[model samples]
Target: MVPDDLLLETRDLTKDFGGFLAVKHVDLRVRRGAIHALIGPNGAGKTTVFNLLTRFLSPTSGSIWFEGRDITRARPAQVARQGVVRSFQISAVFPSLTALENIRVALQRARGGTFRFWRSDRVLEGLDGRALSLLADVGLEDQRDVAAVELPYGQKRALELATTLALEPSLLLLDEPTQGMGHEDVGRVAELIRRAAAGRTVLMVEHNLPVVAGLCDTITVLQRGSILAEGSYAEVSRDPRVLEAYIGAQA
Candidate 1:
């Protein structure tokens, strides 16, 4: 079971691009082995928060604690090595490489062996099994040999998750898994995400509220740059402010 105490925490997190605040003094607590969703309109600083957690952007005046480690100013690679890794909202994969090879490359990178050309041309130790298992886990076992670019949009996203899984991160940060997908494709991908959430800690920034309601046990809604509401789907969705700020858009 996932720990109830927070696996990732931020104390008054803030970010500034010059004088403008992209993310305000926000605080977040994500528990271990649970699925948590972050939702907001465009330009609400969801991506900015991701950058801070991954060490892609340093927080302006906040401290980030992850799995009990203070990584407020850690390097990107260091963050990944410490078991917090992120996947993009858009596809981030090698277009020309096969799904199997994509995961193989990530496995090598996770172990810091991708650059060791001096070793024989053989793949990293045990990577074949790991890559195969990852591909199978994402339900792409049959497509393992297909070039990543040859697959449809949804498959590309699955490939991205497979690559991220090869890194063996304890915490997974997903930008948006359902973006640019058709109804059937969205359902398929949602199930894929469900599989991923079983034993992994997930923090996702998603725009689709219905999807969030169906999948997430807890939801955080942001407006402008800070949280507007947080709770279960029914609790937050029924709030008058949430309805005014969000539901009015679709209705």
Candidate 2:
């Protein structure tokens, strides 16, 4: 049984593709309501780990447990329904849709109302009030009517996060939540991520060390598909193995 204090745990997680082991025997534990970060050099299998956790890709070996339930074989949709929702590396917003509409769509998907296509727009109007509230929570209320494609890149990501929040996930997985943004946008999104993590467990694979240090309570460093070090930012930053790995990856 999963401990009451733990929200997500993985045991000996491994993944292989045609004799190429991408992730190797990863044992991870995330505390309830804590913000944890997975950091590694390039090709360290961060993305593979995320895919495994979300059930987007099945593991070649190992077990995944959430809230004391074994979910290693759970389908992607089933895992999502269990409150483990992930935001994509790329924005998931509908470019053509207005920001409010995009959030409404996510709210509808969470409520299992997507099949009601025959319902008039008036029916969807009921979602507008709730959607607006969500947008306000993300500081996107003024841009609610703006086309997602036309919004600045940072705001686009905010909309995507708002949509993900619509699912009311207990465990949220973020993959590079602050990639490809100007310094200002990075700070903004970092704040947004911090706000989103309230009362929820967040496990993120992030490349920006400064952001990770600023926001994550704990950090796990992976080197060549295996954990090299796990600790707070100050602890891992001074580790020789982590320093060597980062240097080698850059070299």
- 171 in model 1: Cα distance from truth in Å? 0.8
* Cα displacement (Å) at residue 201, model 1: 1.0
In candidate 2, list every pair of residues with a backbone clash. Answer: none
Q: TM-scores for all candidates?
A: 0.93, 0.95
Candidate 2's residue-wise lDDT over 14-40, tens digit each? 999989999999998898998999999
Highest-scoring model, TM-score: 2
Error of 1 at 213 (Å): 1.0
lDDT of 1 at 155: 87
The 0-to-1 C-alpha lDDT of every candidate, in the order given, reads 0.86, 0.90
Give the 10-residue window scoring lowest on summed lDDT in candidate 2.
Answer: 108-117
